[model samples]
Target: MNIVILGAGEVGYHIASRLATEGNDVCVVDQDSERLQVIADAMDVRTVCGKASYPAVLKQAGAAHADLLIAVTTNDEVNMLACQVAHSLFKVPTKLARVREQDYVRHPELFGRDDLPIDKMISPEGEAAKVVMGRLNVSSAQDAREFFNGAIELVEVTVRPKGKLAGLALKELPDVMGELAVYVVAHEHNNRWRVPKGDTVLLAGDSIYVTVEKKHLDRLMKTIDLAYQTPEGRNVMMIGGGRIGYLVAKELEQAGAKVKIIEFNAERAEWLSEHLNNVVVIYGDALDRKLLEEENIDRMDDFLALTNDDENNILGSLIAKRYGVGHVVTLVNKAIYMQLMRQIGLDVTVSPRLSTVATILSHIRKGRIHGMASLADGQLEVLEAEALATSSILDIPLKDLKLPGDTVVGAIMRGNEIIIPNGSVAVKTGDHVLMVTTGESVPEVEKLFAVHLEFF
Candidate 1:
């Protein structure tokens, strides 16, 4: 597929890199020549240097014959205008724009095809907030992704020293945990990722991804010694009052969590105070130890450092953990900081770029892709695709089905029921199957689910 991306920032760079790696013809356009040079030097993609919204720039980026156009410039107006121009002038088949402004996001009618012509609106802040809220909902998980309309969940838990299942082998989990309906699909040990087998032993500090029914989530967490009960009056402290932080605090407050937000900018703090109910807004910097102490940070149930600056967020989260905060979740934009923060004991780290890329890939992917998530720093992927009648893998027992290396069927969603499949279970047409595999195997997995022309 020919793809044109209208930004060269972190999100756009990652998206371009991934799509190019998958053999797509990707062209990136940015006004900054230096950014375009960086992308050109690092990947096998064409780069255009000019204003992205201009017709000449779009044509230079091959928008006329493009299969898809993705506009993710830092400016909201630029992204919207690029999408409109792509549709109006070039007739790009699919147009996606990254829109962050809440004012514009609240009004859907303003973005219809006749007006803005944006086929999909991607919000980095909103996507990051959803990730943060998912982690909060499953407190024991480092991350959680819902599928099949919340009937199934993929939860990531880091094995801790002295934990109940720290040293247990994968096959012994059922015997030890009383036949719980959970599958250990993938795990990362010593920075190596793998789809675990029966003899694979789970060690302390290993991050394991488990697929389980939504109703059994709590029980599975408890079995792994990572259960967190969200009772009334749960305390959460947010370090930044930006869009992502505000959205998360609002959702948590509505769900009965006592929330407090600290903003460095006085004007934003005042606005938050006026607009938010049941939330304490403090005009203070998160790096100030005195301010954290004054707010009794040690007593908070969770501490989230969500500022735009990666250094500040990392420092603030480390300080919160030092002060004995119950849980510390930090927003780390740079990929380099993710492993460092995890090694140093941050409870959860959310990446806006990763979330945005995953969301965009879900739409870019062929076949009946319902959702897609990148895990373990893009080394692994979990995807949800519908099994069509013409799919090659349909009607075959999972155990006997031949799949690419490092792939596992996590769950099958048929109608209202979620099935944790076994060897005897076979996927049928119209079933939404959740599967896990290495990043390199995604194309092969898509082929198995792709409808064949022979059927028609």
Candidate 2:
């Protein structure tokens, strides 16, 4: 596919990297030569240095023959204008843009095909809030992803030393749980990632990934880890009161949890207090331990370090961890620092920038991909798609199905019934299939599912 990307910032960089990895013909445009050079040297992508909204720049980026145009410049007007120019002059079939300003976000009706021409409007703050809340639902999980409109959830939990699951084999899980449904999709032991077979054994320090029906999520969490507990009217505190923080805090308040938000900027703090009726808005720097102590950090059931600065978020989350907070989630913008966070005991970190990247990719994927998630640092992806009648894998039992060695079917949903698939389970037409696969195996998975029909 010929794709043109506007802006070479964090989101654009990751998008180009992923699309290029998938062997797409991608061209990136940005005003910053240094940023363009950085991505150009790192990935197999064309880079154009100029004003992205200019028709000449779009033409230079191959927008005339491009399959899609993505505008993610920092300025919302520039992004919108780039899309309009791409549509008016280049006739690009698909246009996606990032619009984050509250004024623009509050009025989504401002975008339309006739006027704005933006096929999809990406909101990093909104996606980040959803990611944060999903993690909170599975507090003991390393991370969690929802699919099929939240009918199924995928969670990863590290096997703690001496935990009940540390010594069990993969095949024993179903028997141990009696009639409850659960499926072990993959495991990450040491640095190796693979689909776990029946003989695969669980060991301490190994990351185990599983999928279960949403109704049985809590039961599965507790069964996998003896120490797992549900959050009950808990105190949830956030260190940043920015847009992302406000969205998360508002959801937390509506969930009936005690919520508090601390903002470094006095004006924003005042605004948050006036807007959020239930949340306690504090005006203080999160880096000050004295302020956190005065707020009774130890009593917080969940501590969110949502500041924009990666260093401060990391340090603040570490402090919350040291205080024995039940769950410590930090907002890390840079992908480089996120891997370090999990290794240093902060298991969950949200990247709004990368979250927006996933949103864009999901919009670009050719199959009827309901949703997609990157796991194991983008090496692996969980994709949910509908099974077509002509799909090669249908009617054949999974045991005899020829799937990529790096792929595993996590769950299947037929109407309202959720199936934790096994070797004998066969997929039916129109069933929503949730599968996890490596980056290289994605194309093969799509081919096998007969989801080759075009989708924007």
Candidate 3:
């Protein structure tokens, strides 16, 4: 596919890298020549330097023959205008724009075909909030993802240092969890992922992805040594009153949490105070130790550092940890900083760019994929895929089916019934199977979603 990406920022860079790696022709447009040069040096994709919203720039980037146009410039107006131009002039089949401003997002009607002509609107703030809420719901989970419309979930848990059940094998977990139905789909140890087998051992610091039914979620959490941060009247202190911050605070307040927000900007703080009824909105720098102490940050159940400044967010989270806060969630934007974050004792972190990238990929991939999410820094993806008629693995027990070592069938959903598959279960047509696989296994798994005329 030939794709044109507007704005060579982090989102654009990530999307470009992803598509270019998959052998798509990706051209990135940006106003910064240096950024374009940096991208050019790193990836095989083409780069053009100009205001991304300009028609001449789009034309220069081969938008006329593009299969998709992705507008992710920092400016909302630029993204909308670029999409409009791509649709009206270039006739691009798919035009997706990243719209951040609340004015544009709250009203979805403005982006219809008769109006802005944007095929899909991606909101990084909303996506990040969803991730944050997922982690917050499971206090000790490194990450959490729901699929099959909340029927199934994939929770990532890390084995604590010197904790119980640290050196146990995959086969031994069932003994620990006597009655609960759960599967360890994939895990990472020492920077390598394995499709866990009966003898696969889980060591301390290893991160395991467990897929379980939503009904047994609490049991699964407890079995894995992770307690649920139940949404019933919990206390939360949020730093940063930006778009992502406001969205999260509103949701948490509605869920019966006592929420407080510390915002640096006076106007935004006032807007938050007016817009959010139950949540307390305070005007002050989130990084200030004095302000945090004054607000009794130490007593809060959860502390979230959500400011745009990476340094401040990290520093604030460290301070919260110092204050003996049980759970601290931080937001970091730079991809380069993601590695260092885990080394610095940060258990959970969300990146808007990564979330937006996953959303964009799901939209582009399109058919038979009910839902998709990226995990373990994009090395792994848990996807809920619809099995097709005449598929190769259909009607065969899972134990006999050949699959890559880096892939595992976590669960299967057939109509109202949810099945935690063992070796005896077989996939049927129209079943939505949730599978966890590494990036290398995508091509192999794609075949299971294909239809064959011979079988039909």
How many angstroms is residue 335 displaced in model 1 relative to the true structure, after the best TM-score fit? 1.8
Q: What's the TM for model 3?
A: 0.95
Better candidate by lDDT, 1 or 2: 1
Computed on alpha carbons, the lDDT of every model, listed in order, comes to 0.87, 0.86, 0.86
Segments in model 3 whose C-alpha atoms lie over 4 Å from true places: 451-456
Q: Write the per-residue lDDT of candidate 2 for residues 141-174, one digit (tens) a residue.
A: 8788888888898988888888878788988876
Worst 10 residues of 3 by lDDT: 447-456
Displacement of the residue 403 alpha carbon in candidate 2, Å: 0.9
Give the number of the best model, judged by lDDT.
Answer: 1
What would the TM-scores of all predictions be?
0.96, 0.96, 0.95
Tens digit per residue, CA lDDT, model 1, 1-456:
899999999999989988898788999999999999999999999999999999999999999999899999999999999998999999998898999999999898887778889888999999999999888888768888898889998998888898877899988888877878888899888778889888999998998988999998888877766765652477888889999988888898888989889999999999999889999999988888889899999899888898889999988988988888767789989988976776777858899989999998877775487778998778899989899888998888989999999999999988888899888999999999998998788888988999321100
lDDT of 3: 0.86
Clashing residue pairs, backbone N/CA/C < 3 A, model 3: none
Pairs of residues at least 3 apart in sequence or in different chains that clash in candidate 1: none
Worst 10 residues of 2 by lDDT: 223-232
So what's the TM-score on candidate 1?
0.96
